[model samples]
Structures are given as C-alpha cells and as structure tokens.
Target: MSGEEYRIGLIHATMNSVQPILDAFQVHAPQVTLVNFMDESLIYELNETGIVTRNMARRLLNLVEKAVMGGVEGVLLTCSSFTPVVAEISHLFEIPVLSADLSMLEKAIDMGNRIGVIATVEAAGPTTKTLLETISSNKQKDVIIQTVIIPKAFHALQNGNRSKHDELIHQKVQELNRDCDVILFAQFSMVRALETLDFTTVPILTSPEISVKSIIAEITKRRIVI
Candidate 1:
C-alpha cells in the first residue's frame, strides 16, 4: 500500500462466495485493497423465508461501522438483502458506504417496466420487493417484480457445492426469463454464475459492475474532499 493506494472494506453479511468478489475488484479496482468481513447473521432466516428482518439489518450496520474503523475510503456490502442497512449506515458515517443493490437496481430501471428478481435467500426477496415498490412509486412509475427463491441451492452453496449451486441458478433463470422484461441477480455471489447464464431476451443485471463503479466513484470522491 502506498500514499495513492485506496483501501476499501467489503462487508458481506453472509459467508459470501468470495472468488468473483475479489476478482471483480482486482480488475476494476487494482489500486484498492479489498478487505473483507463475513457475517452469516442472516443465514438461517434468509434460507428459510427470503426476508431480511430488522434485527439482521442492525448487524449489517455494525459491520459497516467496523469497516469505517478499519480506515477504508468506502464500504460496500455485497448482499442485496442489506440495502436498507447500507443506507442507514451511510447516513451515520462521514465516509462513503455504498449499497451494491442500489447501484445494480439503477440499471434495472432502464431495462423496462416489469422486473424479474431472482434471489438465493429469503431475506433478499422481501427487501428487494420493498425497494422496487418504493423506487418505482417514487418515480410515479409502476413495476411488477416477480421474485423466485432458490433456498435449496443457496444451501448447496453454503455447504460448498458451488457447481450445483450455479446449475440451479441457470435453471431458475431460464424459467424466470419467460415471465419478466428483465433479470436482476440479488447477490454478488450470483454474478459469476450470472455471467454464464443464457440471458434470454432480457438483460441480466449483476451488482458487481455497478458496485465496483460505485466504490471507485466514492473512493475518488473522498480523496478529493481530503
């Protein structure tokens, strides 16, 4: 690390599939160090039900505060289920802490009126539903967000059958494509799998692309401010 080097902390409120998350930063943010923290805080609830409870949201914020203390220029949490948690943290921190989901969903807005959300956990599903409803309504636009849950396969990922996990996702997207105008993967771990998906006629939006950009922009913003 040097004077010009940027240090970033990525908080994963789950034991997130880390390979692609690291790879994305290496390519998109070579000068930045991507320090990571794991919080399987929502694992059971998410896998069983697909909704992020308020209690889980609190842990996510606590992690962001930890990242800030680590001297990171910015923090980005990779799970979509914690979007609100990210927002709540950013409001408290002086440094930038970004919502990976917020950046990714911005792309979904451009794709069309009907959004298809494919999620691995229970918490992400309900949080995404609320996010879509709030944003679409704020713009005076409407969207029909169709949600699909892959709890079994997500557990497979947790237990280490990554290949099986990816295959299940590909299978789910095939069906998801038939019903909505576009597709949005709800987790950062889903990106590597998503890149290989059939993609149908709809666009497949992964958070990493937007999230990496968001991180870079925020890091650069803080550098200028100081």
Candidate 2:
C-alpha cells in the first residue's frame, strides 16, 4: 500500500509533542492521513500520580481502540512514559501499534555501548531506562545507560518559553556528550530542542523521525490497505 492509502493515528499525552511528529510526517510521508488524539490531562495526571496506574493503561488502550474503530491503518503513541502500556495492549489490535520511542531505543542500542538519555519529563526517564535494560538483556548486549531529567525545561515549555526550554536541554546535552557514546532524546516533546544547538560529535537520536519511518515500514511490510 502507498502512503496515500494509510490513515495513521497518533495519541499524544501532551500538546507539545504533537507538532514535531506532524512536521516529520509531512516531510517524510505527506500523503498519509493523520488522525490525532490528544489528552493533555494525561500528562498532568501522570505527574500527579508519579507512575502509570492500571486505570491509566486502560485509558491508553481505549484511545488505541477508538483509533482502530475510526478506520485508522496504524496507531502510534507519542508519550514515552506510556510505552509499556502501549506494549501491553498491542496484541489486541489488528493494525500496527507503536510507541514513539521504541525505534529510537533500538537504534540507540545498536549505535554504541554507552547510551545517554536526556529527557524533559520526569516519568519518561525511568520508563526509558527500564526499556533499554530489557532490550539489552534480550539482545545479550552489555550496555550502560544514563538518564538525566530536566523538569525545569519541561515547565518552561509548558509555560510557553521555548527558548528557555531549548537552552536548558542544550546545556544538558553538552554535559552528557562528554561521557556517552550516543545520546537519545527520551520524549517526543524534547526533539524541538535540537533545532537550537549544533552537536556534531555524538550522534543525537530523537523519536519522531524514527517512529514515523517505523510506522511507514510496518504498513508496507504487512501490506495493510486502508
């Protein structure tokens, strides 16, 4: 099937992550139709609870189910903190289901032994760390992972201070570059910070582009027609 025949569903936990993913899709797969489902309250609730509860998982499942019922050819969850939940319900859906960070994590694991994750969201750091550990164990690869979270940057973005957010993340990236073999931006929302800085040394990875490509590849591989 071609890009024009696919309708991709995106579930966003926060509004900040949506634009970057949309921009990537436009450049990489413009013909595909985008179906966005956003619930900004999910971020607030996750921050309040400090973890993804059972009810939170069910809410994510409902969003994916709605996208499936709406005739979407694939569903992608744009929240790093909710990746495990997406994995849990992926078997229930006939269409392709993806977590925004899955492809990025795979790439990071393959790139080097020491991986650094820079994240704006508090919950994302631990979730990504857990994922990296699991993937490394399964692949029988000895990998070292380090995660740094800048809550201030996230709050700055939430308050509409894009420059401040970028500045904070850029500083963290520079610090991490010294020790890590590769750096991965843990949240889809954090990808915007890359525009402000030029880091030519360590390879910096982000979720949106990789996730977009992965979804497109899955659509083609399965020969799913929408």
Give the per-residue lDDT of model 2 (tens digit) for 37-83: 97888899998887999988888888898899999989999999999
lDDT of 2: 0.89
In order of appearance, the predictions have TM-scores of: 0.88, 0.96
Q: What value does the lDDT take at residue 184 in candidate 1?
A: 86
- Residue 24 of model 1 has an lDDT of 77
Looking at model 2, how many pairs of residues clash? 0
Cα lDDT tens digits for candidate 1, 69-154: 88887888877777877666587988888886886776687678889888887777778778878888777787888888787777
Q: lDDT scores for all predictions? A: 0.77, 0.89
